[model samples]
Target: MKFIHAADLHLDSPFLGLTGLPSSLLATVRQSTFTAATKVFDQALAQQVDFVLLAGDLFDRAEQSVAAQAYLFQQFDRLDQAQIPVIVSFGNHDYLADQHQTVAYPKNVTVLGSQVTTKTLTLADGETVAISGFSYPQRWVASDPLPDFPVHAATDWHIGMLHGAVATGSDDHYAPFTVDELLSKRYDYWALGHIHHRQTLNQQPPILYAGNTQGRAINETGAKGAYLVTSDHGHLQPQFFSTATIEWATATLDAANLTTLTALGTRLTDWLASQPAAQPTLTALTVTHLQLDATDLTSLRQGEWLNLYLRTHARQLKAAHRYLVSVTPQVQPQALTAPQLDQQYWDQGAAAVFTPANLQATFGKLAQEPALADWFTQATQDATLRPQAEQVLAELMGKEDPDVS
Candidate 1:
C-alpha cells in the first residue's frame, strides 16, 4: 500500500551551462545525479516501502554512460537485498533499444517492455497491487497510447505508469493522453513522467508527476525530489521529499544605486551573505531597476563582469557555499520607449527579428555543432531567448539616438 514514485533520474548526465566553477563544486556537480538518486534508495530502505515506481527517463541511453549503467545495477542490487520491488518504464531518453538488451538488471527490478503490460505484486501486508505501463520503443511515440492501456485490474490497488505528456493536439512526439482518458481507466493512481516539473492533475486518485530527482539547470529551479505515497483512509496521498545535494535558484537584486561592476560585486556578495540554503546553491542573479552605460551593460551581457566577479569574489562565494551561474540585467520594455521610435515600431521589429527562421539564420555555422544546435533549439522553444533578444535591442537603442524625421 506504500511506495515511492520518482522519474527523470538522468543519471550521469553532465550539468548544462556551467563554466569556471570551483574544483570542489565541479566534483559535486559531476556526482550530483548519483547522489540525489542515492537519497531515494536510502528512503526506500529506511521507510521499508513495499515497492518503488520509476516512471521514466532513468538515464540517457544516447550518452552511453558506463557510470550510469553501473550505478543502476548496484542500486537495483541493493533494493533486491532489501526485498523491495522496483517497476521502471523507460522514457524517450532511455528507450528500449537493441544495444542494451543483453545487459540485465537485478532480480527485483522489473523494466516494463515496449508493449503495454501489467505487473502484479502481492505485498507482505496481503495487499495486491497491479501496475500497468510501457517503455518508449524509440525516441518518439507520436500516438495516443491510451487505447493500448488495459482497464483496471482486479486487485486491491491499480496504478498506471506513463512516461508522456498531455495531448497538445499537434506536434506531440511523446505519448500524449488527456486527463479524461487517464481517469476513464479508473485506476487508483497515475505515476506520470517526462515533464520535469512536479504537478498533480487530479487529487482524488493521486495523478501526478514526481519531477526530476535533482535540479540540473536554472530553469529547473527550486526543491527537486520524489514522492512517497501511502494509502490513507481509502485514498492515496503523496508527500514530497528533497533529494538534491545542490539547488538552483534565481533572485532579483535591486540595482537602484548601483552604477559600476565593483558595486555590483559588493552588492552580490552582501546578498549571498544575507540568504542561505540548506544545500549548496547555484544562483542566477538578475539586476532590476538599474540604468547602465553601453560599456557596463555589455560587460554583464557578455559575461565578462560575471567572470571577473567570480574570480575576485571567490572567498565570499565559498563562504556562502554558492556559485553565481549568471548575472543578467532586466531591461524593462518601458525603459526602451524612445522619444522618436514608437511602441508599434518596436513591436514590428520584434515580430520581424524574433522568428525561428531569423534566429536560425543568425545562428548560422554554430548550428552545425550538435551541442550548440541542441541548446539553440531548446532555448528557442522556451521564453529564455525572447528576453535576451529584447535586452540586445535595448542595448542597441541605448547606444544610438535615432531620428524619426
Candidate 2:
C-alpha cells in the first residue's frame, strides 16, 4: 500500500515578485512550476506507486490557461498508462465547477464531487481501502466539513482528504476543522491541503499536508515537494522529496572589511565565485556590519548599485548558477541606540509604535488617499517595519556623522 500525496500544484502560477531578471533566468522561472510538476509525475512512474493523491489547488481555474489544462490531461494519461489511480480533490483555487468538467480526466483519475463521498479500492494484494473527500464548490467554504465525514470504514485502511486550514475561531474562510475533530473520525491517515507549507498535524495515523510542489515566491523559500507514504507495520511512514528546480533563499554577507562601492561589488563577485549552486537559486542577500558611506548606502537602498552589479557580473552570476534578487543593508540596532535611551527602552518604544493600531492611528486622515492608503496599509502590515525604520534612522545618523561608530 504505497501512494504519493501532493497538493497545491498551482501549475499556472506567475512566480510573482520576480522582475528585472535576465531573459534566460526569467524563462527558467516561468517554466519552474511545470518542471517541478513533471518531477512529481516522474517520481510516481519510477516508484510505481499504487495510487497518487492530489489534495487540491491543482490549477487556478480563473486563469483559463489552455497550457495548464493540456498538461494535466497529458500527465494524467501518463499515469493511466501505468495503471496508477489518481484521486483529486480540488481546493478553493480550482473548486468544483460545471465549466471545468466540460472535459473529463483520464479513466484512472477520480475527482471527488462537492459532497462528501467514499471511494473504495481493492489493491492487488487483496487489501481493501476507503478514501473519502470532497472538492470546494466555490472560492470559500466557511462551514466545517468534519461533521460530514463518517468514522473509519470497515476496510484495511481509511484515509480522509481535506483541503482547508484548522479552526482559527475567526476569519477562517476555508473549510476549518480541529485536530480533535479529525482524530474523532479515527481515520488511518488524513491528507491535507490549502496551507502551502508541508507539515504534520499528528504522527499517529498521520495527519499531513503535502504542501505545494513548487516555490512560487520568495516567501515560499526552501525545498518544495510532495511526500511518498508507505505502509509500515500497522503504521504509515512518509518521506519528503524535493521537486522544485529552482529555490529561493536569503543569505547575509559581512561588510566589516569593505568601505567603497567598488570593494563591495568585488567582494560580492568573489563570494559568488566561492560558492556555486547545484540548481538555479534566487538569493536575497543582506550586507551586515556595514561600514559604507551614506552615498554608497543610498545607492544600495535605491537598487542602482545592485542593478549595475548584476549587469556587469552577468557571466559570474550565470557561472555560479545564482541570481541576486535583492541586496540591502542590515543596520545593527545598537548603532541606532542613543545615549539618553537604553537598548531595551528603544526596543519597547519601537514595538509600541509599530503596532497595527498605533500605526493606523498615526496614519490618520492621510490614509484616505487611494495610492498612499494602499502603501500605508501594506506598511502597517509589514512585520519588518520597525527594523526597516531603525535602519533608515541609522543610515541618517551615519550620513550626519561619518565617524559615528
lDDT of each: 0.85, 0.84
lDDT for each residue of candidate 2 in 9-92, tens digit (9 for 90 to 100): 888777655676798889888888888899999999999998999998888444548788889899999999999999999887
Residue 171 of model 1, lDDT score: 59
Return the TM-score for candidate 2, rounded to 2 decimals.
0.82
- Backbone collision count in every prediction? 0, 0
Clashing pairs in 2: none
Q: List model 1 lDDT by residue over 138-166, tens digit each.
A: 77788999998888899999999999889
TM-score of each: 0.88, 0.82
Q: Candidate 1 overall Cα lDDT vs. reference?
A: 0.85
Give me candidate 1's TM-score against the actual structure.
Answer: 0.88
Q: Which ranges in model 1 have alpha carbons more than 4 Å from their true place? A: 98-102, 334-387, 390-405
Q: For model 2, where is the 10-residue window of minimal lDDT?
A: 370-379
